[model samples]
Structure formats: structure tokens, C-alpha cells
Target: MSTESVQGGGNDPAIEVTPEAAEEALSLLEGEELDTDEAGLRLFVQQGGCAGLSYGMRFDTEPEPDDLVVEHHGLRVFVDPASRNYIGGSKLDYESGLQAAGFHVENPNVVSECGCGESFRT
Candidate 1:
């Protein structure tokens, strides 16, 4: 994966999205029939997981006022400023296997994760 920095949000570099992940996100967005120009994938970190932090993603029609928007492979990604600190330099990847197919994050800031791998602590 390649790394690139985004301006105007904070010191941390914006999270990177793999080509496969970008394509998958685009596919999902298309399935919802959302206007590509007006829609984006929002990535955020929320509290309350076993490890104190849990990642979240969803299709959003509009970004927050202070969101850092990055376009990858023609797909728009919105990362909130607060989550940027914990997810900077991370890579978003989609993995497919016989047993599971899902999006996975390789976050450099993650110091630990729960046994079930549902939550993380930085």
C-alpha cells in the first residue's frame, strides 16, 4: 500500500485505503444507488468496546463540517479529526477467504486488541 498525507485536519497522515478496499467500498455505494458525487464512506473510532475503542464504517451522504475528505481510486473517504489520531498511517484492506470476507484495518497505532479481535487499544 502507498502512504500519503492530507492537509487541514491535523498532523497525522490520513489513513490509506488499498485498491481492493476502495473498489469494494465503491461497489457497496453503487448498490445503494447513492450519487457518487454526494456520497462517501465515513470511518470513525468510537468508545465502548471491550478494549475501549472500536472502529466503525458506513456510507454517508454528507460529511461533517470538519471532516477530512480523501479520494482514493475514485471513492471518497471521510475521516473525522478525532479518529485521525488513532488511525493515521493505517491501511484499509478487504480480505476474502473460504470462511470470511470483510474489511480489515492494519493500524500502526494499535497497541493491543481483544482476544475476539473486535476491539482495540492504542
Candidate 2:
């Protein structure tokens, strides 16, 4: 998508996507035959976890009008304003190990998390 199409909260975006994640996301988009320029991964925070916050993501055909858009390694990430408050300064990474292999969020804003590691609080 064009830079003008992105409603970035500021020139400096707090979210970062690692190269491995970008590559995996790009591959997924291509495999789905989605338009890379418009379709992207949408990251957000939900309030159902044991610690009150949880990370969520999905492939979106396009970003919402007010979503913050950040691109890295040719991968576009869309974040909603509300979620921004909970997930700022977070890193999106892809792990290909046999166990727990999937997208993981390394959030620096987290203050604590459940012992099971499925939820977090800030």
C-alpha cells in the first residue's frame, strides 16, 4: 500500500517484525493469492487472557482507515489504535521449531504474565 494510505500514529512506529516473520507472512499472503500491496497481517490485543491481555493476528485484505501501518522486509503490519496501547514496542517473530512453532510476540511492555504463559498483563 502507498505510504499515504497508512494512518500511522507517528512517523516512528513502535512495532517491529523480524525478518523470519516477514518472510513467513509474505509466503502466506502469496499462497493465498492476496494482493501484497493491500493485504497484510493485522496485529491486535484482546482482553480475554488470564492476565487481561493477549496478542492476536490474522490476514486482512486491507487495513482499516485508522490503523497504524508499518512495513518491514516488504511485509505490512496493521495495528488498531486501541491495541496500540497494549502492544507498543512489541516484536513479531516466527519460530519454526517442532514444538510451539508459530508466530510469537516479544512484548517489552508486559509487566507480568500467567504461569502457563498463555496470557500477560501490563
Candidate 3:
């Protein structure tokens, strides 16, 4: 990741991917047989988790015309316009350890998170 701190700019991309996350995502893409020129990582926010909102990620072959697209560490990231406000300036990370291992979001916009850590409120 860059040394520069992330900030929310009106015209900036909604989210940023750390180098670690991008590399891990790329590896997963290949492992899952989803690696392709048109495939990209798609991140979005949805309602109905323990804290009322949750994050979703997947490999998408097509992106909406109005989505916020960002390219970092050789990975293409897509964020739906509706999710921009919720995840703007957030950092995507991957962690592998004895206790837990998966993709996690470090979101500055979250005001609170559920105890289980599966959801958050903004």
C-alpha cells in the first residue's frame, strides 16, 4: 500500500485495495477459474446483516455503466454507485492466521460494528 493516508474526495474512487488484498484476490481469481480479461473484483454493500449493513464481494465479468471503477496493484475493483457513500475511503485487506483468515474491510465510515463482526452501521 502507499504511504499516503486515504481520504474521501468527491470525485475519487469509492474504495481502495491494499497491495496484499489485490494480490490475494488475484490468486483467488485464478484458483477459482475466474481469471479473465473481462473479470474484475466487485465490492458492494447490502442491508440485513446483524448491524443492518454488510459487505459483499465477488468476481464480476460485467460492470454497470455507472459503477465506480478503480485499478490498483494490477486488479480492477468495481463499486456500485449506491455503495460508494458507505464504503468510500475504505481499505480492503486479507488476513491469514490461526484464528481467522479471509478478506476484511477497514472502513473509516463505520460508526459501529456488531459483536460477531459480520456487519456494521455507518
N/CA/C clash count, model 3: 0
The most accurate candidate by TM-score is: 1
lDDT tens digits by residue: candidate 1, 1-122: 44343535666577778899988998999999987777988988999678999999999997788888877777778889889888877888899999999999899999999998989999
**lDDT on C-alpha atoms for all candidate structures:** 0.84, 0.85, 0.80
lDDT of 1 at 47: 96
Clashes of each: 0, 0, 0
How many angstroms is residue 35 displaced in model 2 relative to the true structure, after the best TM-score fit?
Answer: 0.6
Q: For candidate 2, lDDT tens digit of each residue in 1-122?
A: 22223357775446788889888999999999999988999999888777888888999999898888888788889999899888877889999986767899998888999988778998
- Ranking of candidates on TM-score, top first: 1, 2, 3
Number of the candidate with higher TM-score, 1 or 3: 1
Q: How far does residue 109 in candidate 2 sit from its true spot (Å)?
A: 0.6
Q: Candidate 2: what lDDT?
A: 0.85
State candidate 2's TM-score. Answer: 0.89
Clashing pairs in 1: none
TM-score of each: 0.90, 0.89, 0.86
